[model samples]
Target: MASVTYILFVSSVVQAQEQANIEKLGVERVNPADVKAAEDIADQILTKMAEGSYYEFKEGEAIPEIVQLFTKDTQKQAYQQIKAQVGEYLSSLEFQEAYSLSQGGMEATIFRFKGDFSKSEPEVRVVLDRDDKLAGLRVLPWTDQL
Candidate 1:
């Protein structure tokens, strides 16, 4: 009975997120003449993120499948659950710095955030498609020791 309620809640959230993604991406045609425009679109999206307003653009909803790469699916409820755990960890600490890297043809941005959690910094990577849509996300609480 309790499990059924939990499942229903999660399913509702996923369906809501999927709808939000469709609206956020919208329906637009891209072409050579729109190259700069496309870049602008990406820049606008990233800039908004940098400003610390991170959430689904469609309002009152979570971003959809920010971890699709690891799951190989368009929607990943498991990924969303893992992400919430990581987000909680970050939110619990007093963060000091945020560093970002986008290199070597990887359509992803890796952000390192230092916080009171430990001497080890937590990191997040967001991969985006050519249309500037989110493809996936990875969160690491600490750097792997070699």
Candidate 2:
């Protein structure tokens, strides 16, 4: 019984250490390289929308499953509101600029998209895990004069 307890405790410690390592290694660098990579993503989104309606970027593994689920449920409504203001999907839009780079225990990239002046400002937020990899993106609903 003593040996079994010791083994379990060791195993738990190893597992926790491994998780910490993964988080440390995965935390993507917050530099121009990362910013450009994200810009590439925004560019791809534009290209797909220009090509056709069925375009989608490949999913990043860093993104959590629950976040994906939420996106699935609310994407349509969220996009509808944004499209009404922005003129199309994420394509045909420019990353006006990053309004803020707020870092909490988890960091976020908050940016504004340039759309029609007549419409309300449409914004997108990308949440990152401890390692700085994208965990999910949230598109706010439209607040224009519908």
Candidate 3:
């Protein structure tokens, strides 16, 4: 009986720690307007990439400053790599959360999404600058196996 009680206490503490870690990441609910804008931009970009129209984003779709960070060639290569590894797009994208961070006096919002690919489900993060331009983007494999 005492062992059972101890186990329950330990489980609760572990759950609280996990919640705290998530909060430390700055994840929080964002305004509905911001969520809509970010989702629209992210979805548009992802859709285009899935359709093999990588070069089209070189225009107004993405900010030139941020695009230079990855370079056009590198961006195309990354897209191809994802396509090869993840197969084709499966279209199960759902907004997960958003976080705000400041760097060099500029504020950026990170929008996260749990998206389905042909091979696996990955978390997609799209960072937008104050002007609503893409500042950074990344796709990482996500799993509950942890």
Global lDDT of each candidate: 0.30, 0.37, 0.57
Give the residue spans of candidate 3 off by over 4 A: 1-29, 55-61, 69-72, 143-146
Ranking by TM-score: 3, 2, 1
Rank order (by lDDT, best first): 3, 2, 1
Provide TM-scores for the models: 0.27, 0.44, 0.66
Q: What are the per-residue Cα lDDT tens digits for candidate 3 across 93-127? A: 78777766654455656677776878766766666
Using lDDT as the measure, which candidate wins? 3
Q: On residues 38-146, what C-alpha lDDT tens digit does candidate 1 reach at each position?
A: 2333233333333443323433112244322222221234334433443322332221222222333322221222322222334433333444444433334544320
* lDDT against true structure, model 3: 0.57
Residue 128 of model 2: what lDDT? 38
State the weakest 10-residue window (summed lDDT) of model 1.
1-10
RMSD of 2: 15.1
Better model by TM-score, 1 or 3?
3
Which predicted model would earn the best TM-score? 3
Residue 60 deviation, candidate 2, in Å? 4.0
